[model samples]
Target: MTAIAVTIAGTDPTAGAGIQADLKTFSALGVYGATVMTALVAQNTTGVQGVHDVPAEFVRAQMRSVFTDLDVDAVKIGMLSRPETIRAVADGLAEFAARNIVLDPVMVAQSGDPLITPEAVATLRDTLLPMAMVITPNLPEAARLLDADPAGDEHAMLEQGRRLLDLGPEAVVIKGGHGTGAESVDLLVTQDEVVRLAAERIATRNTHGTGCTLSSAIAAGLATGAPLASAVRAAKDYLTAALAAADDLRIGHGQGPVHHFHALWPNLPGEKR
Candidate 1:
């Protein structure tokens, strides 16, 4: 059976982030991908120029449309930039009793562009955070959730990840790639245990969609019946490989995108769809 996963996110014309990246990651992981566009963003590797958010009613409608047809093994959410859209997502998921939901706290972009508004942040925390099976936030996003500076070290990252867990997510992953280090260490704080997933940070300018790709990869794993920790571990490995192969092809003049199809055509052991 093909695992079916849905991604609720804004659109990135460059396909380096948002729903575009989410769909590509899902397919690469051998999961069927569905999407609900919350917004349309005119963006590239360089920056975002415009954003048009979908209405709250429309977002809810899309959710209903998808849930009614697909069992939806997992759902990955990103780029809910408005208070209305955030609330609609929470309500829609609750209405469908959506399970194995992965939320990527996409507060900012690789180009340092603010994706969500101040009001939306509060809605995301108070309303949507509790709805996720896991919430993946980088150091900067974790800091924004606490209204402080980004974690400067691993200790700080873990500490903040624990704090975020209290907000009601089943687990919180504080991405350490943004921190200063030769290796990236992601802290996974859960009710049962704290798991540290460390990987050698690859050097490349082609890292435009790391956050979106990682979260979607996790969602795909969950959709395929992997445990939470196992899902995260698999996601980390996939992201590392994708990032490593990113520079092999030139997609944009600015920061290029990671290779989502790196494993798609290659017949890897259990990865053949």
Candidate 2:
């Protein structure tokens, strides 16, 4: 059977994040992609200018429409800008009995603009956290979700991951991209063990939709029947290569997106393919 993954996320006009990025990641990983949009965001790689949210009931309707027809193998959930939107997604997931849910708790944009409200964040942490198979949160996002200080070191990151694991996800991946280090590290924490995945930090300002891409890649892997750890490892490797090749494309003034098609694109003159 063909692997299918659905992305329930917002819209990014620049196609760097949200549903657009999710679909790109899914296709890059050879998974069939579907989407449910929660918001129409007027933004780009520079920053988010404005957001118009889809009604909660409409969000539910979209989910129902997709879930009924598609035998979705995995789901990658991204931005839910409002509290009601979060609730609606949670309810719909239960209604359909979705599996292999990869939750990326997106709170802020790459430009430092806030994408979700405090109330919505609380709702996501409370209502949706427990339903996720794996939750991926960067340093600041983990701190915000826990209502605690950001984790500074490996020990602190593990402690925070453990706390998040208690909230119901089978595993938690704490991304270390925001931290000051020569090599970026991400810790995958489960009840059984903690696996550290690291890569040489690429020196580029273009990493607009990294979290969205990683989560969607994981969903693609899961849709293909890979184990959680294997999925995560593969996703990390893909993202690292994409980041390394980000400068190959000039998308916008601010942080450009990672090269989602880096591996497939032909190696052109003076460009890293």
Candidate 3:
């Protein structure tokens, strides 16, 4: 049987993030990928220029079309920019009783551009967080979800991870890429156990789709029937490798994208996606 993974996200023409990055990650991990677009973004490596949202009804229609025919193993959600879109996804997931939903609370872009509306934040917390099997949030996003300042230390990061778990996710992983350190550390907090995953920080400017790539990679793992801890560990490893290989294909001038096909094409020339 083919493992299937679906991504609900916005579009980035640069193919560095959002649906494009997600689908690429799924394929690279050997999972069949599907998509439902919530918004169309006009942007590049530098910053976001504009956004055009899809109707909530249409988004739901896309979900129904995919779920009805395919036995989706995992669903990866990103960039729900409106309250209506968030509600639509929540309702659709409920209909499917989605078990392996991985929620990436994507707020701002790597270029520091906001991708979601202020109204969607509360809706996302109250409506979608409970349905997620795992939620991946960076420090600032975690703070926004909890309505607190960004966690300044590791202790605070773990504490906030616990707090996010209280909101109903089975697990929460706090990504440490934004923090200052020689090694990047990620905290995976759950009701049963908390695992701290750390890796040597790779110095690279090609970090445009880091969050999207990691979350989608986790979804791919889950689609392959891997346990949550194992999935996260593997995803982190994949992200580190992708980041290291990011310079292999310098797509844009500002920030480059991770080489999702690095393992297969080790010496790929820098080509525009």
Candidate 4:
């Protein structure tokens, strides 16, 4: 059977960070992808100009439309700008008994623009954190979720991850991409162990959709029945390769996007550098 994954997120006009990025990552990783848009975002690599959140009832209806017919194997959740939308998604997950849920607590955009509300953040923490197989948060996002200072080192990262684990996620992956280092590190912390996954911190400004890509990549792996840890490792490798190739694409003026099809489109335009 073909593996299928769904992304319940928002729109990114640049196709780099929200629903579009999730779908791209799914396709690149060889999984069928479905999307339920929660917002219409007017944004580019520069910054978010505006947002129009989809109604909560419509969001619920969209989830039902996908869940009732499709054999969704995994779910990748992204931006839910409103508390009601977060609740709607949480309820739909339970309603459909969704499995292999990977949640990316996206509070801020790569451009340093805020993407979610404080009220919605609280709702996501209370309602969805416990239901996910894994929750991926960058350093700043982890800090926001825990209401503490962002982890400055590996030890702090693990500590915060453990705290988040206490909130009920089976595992917490605290991303060190936002930290300063020779190598970007991510910690996969579960009740049993802490696994350190590190990659060279590629120097580039094309990281617009990184969080969405990584989370969706995990969803793609899980959709094919990979274990949580294995899925995370694979996703990391994929992102690293994508980042390495990111500079080849000349997209926006500010932060561009990772090359989702780096391997598949070797000879494509703007990649001949």
lDDT of 3 at 190: 95
Which regions of candidate 2 fall more than 4 Å away from where they truly are? Answer: 270-273
After superposing candidate 3, which stretches have Cα over 4 Å from the reference?
Answer: 268-273
TM-scores for every candidate against the unseen true structure: 0.96, 0.98, 0.97, 0.98
Candidates' lDDT values, in order?
0.92, 0.95, 0.94, 0.95
lDDT, residue 110, model 4: 90
Candidate 4 per-residue C-alpha lDDT over 1-273 given as tens digits, one digit per residue, 9 for 90 to 100? 999999999999989889999999999999999989999999999999999999999999999999999999999999998999999999999999999999999999998889898788888999999999999999999999999999999999999999999999999999999899799999999999999999999999899899999999999999999999999999999999999999888898889999999899856674443
lDDT of 2 at 243: 97
By lDDT, the better pick of 2 and 3 is: 2
Model 1, span 1-273: residue lDDT tens: 879999999999989989999999998888999999999999999988989989999999999999999889999999999999998999999999999999998988899999999999999999989989999999889999988888898888888988999999999989998877789899889988999999998999899999999999999999999999999999999999999878665787799899888765554454422
Tens digits of per-residue lDDT, candidate 3, 72-179, equal 999999999999999999999999887799999999999999999999999999999999999999999999999999998889999999999999999999998889
lDDT of 4 at 62: 99
Model 1 lDDT, residue 50, Cα: 89
For candidate 2, the per-residue lDDT at 167 reads 89
Pairs that collide, model 4: none
What's the number of clashes in each of the models?
0, 0, 0, 0
